[model samples]
Target: MTGNTNSIENAGDPPRRDQSEPRRVHITRGLVDVLLELAEENEPSEMNVVLDATPASSFDATFDLDPETPILTHFYLPSAGQSVRKVFGVDLGTPAGRGRARFLTHPQGPFKLTERDDFAAVVLLAVPPWDDDTLGAFDRSGRKLELVVVDAEPPVEEL
Candidate 1:
């Protein structure tokens, strides 16, 4: 892999782990609180966040997963005008089906690997109808990527 080669390879791919490996979103209670606070402020619409996914250390005796686990930890609020498309730098901000706008979807559809996926880990999507927030992970190439959800320790102090 060369300089740009790595970036190109990462596009449309997970940042830390192989697509074939299992995944679990390790977010902190504080992160969830912040997201909820943003949602409440914005009231319904959607707030999308892009974050770097890194491998988290595990110490559970019963914890059994390959070391290749990629933890999606993107948890933050977007600025006044920032958007996923703008951040990703693809398409012309085209909205998806059902008149809902601003969803992070691959313009060419999933599994279409590019340099972007290699670097970008995941986009935290917060939409209305937030009740059913859990969706089992899936590969962009269309395979069932199993997921595990755990409340992680806050990455930062709650000053």
Candidate 2:
């Protein structure tokens, strides 16, 4: 799949870090497509995709996809749960049995994700439902997907 390298921030002084300010993160279409493909290939009972600011800090959304549609969809931040469901539609949580995706925040300070960061990598952890759990179910298994945002290709201005 072709990836788009669009920098989320413009050339200027970086924004000051303030806990009071709300930060917006951008997930590329390419990254979403890759996750979709992975879900289609390996049908897991539950999937956890986390967008983490640091190893210990993050926010996440989880979905229970056992039913024809998701039986339950939750978010670490209650405020974002509904909007995320609406935005992604049912496609995101359908393939995996009961998917759980999360966006993590910093452990100590406020959310530290900034445009200056090289790229944000999403870590996916897949597990089977308790009913299907086996001896090795406790084993930790997952994939780390990286998204690199470049500034070389900017959008053309309309005439």
Off by over 4 Å in 1: 1-30, 58-63, 74-76, 80-126, 132-138, 141-145, 154-159
The C-alpha lDDT values of all candidates are 0.41, 0.29
Q: After superposition, how far is residue 62 of candidate 2 from its true place, in Å?
A: 33
Residue-level lDDT for 17 in candidate 1: 58
Which consecutive 10 residues in model 1 have the weakest lDDT in total? 94-103
| Candidate topping TM-score | 1
In the range 64-91, model 1's lDDT, one tens digit per residue, is 4454554444433345234655787643
Q: In candidate 2, what are the lDDT values of residues 81-131, reduced to their tens digit?
A: 556678866444333432233432222222233332222222222222211
Q: Estimate each model's TM-score.
A: 0.41, 0.21
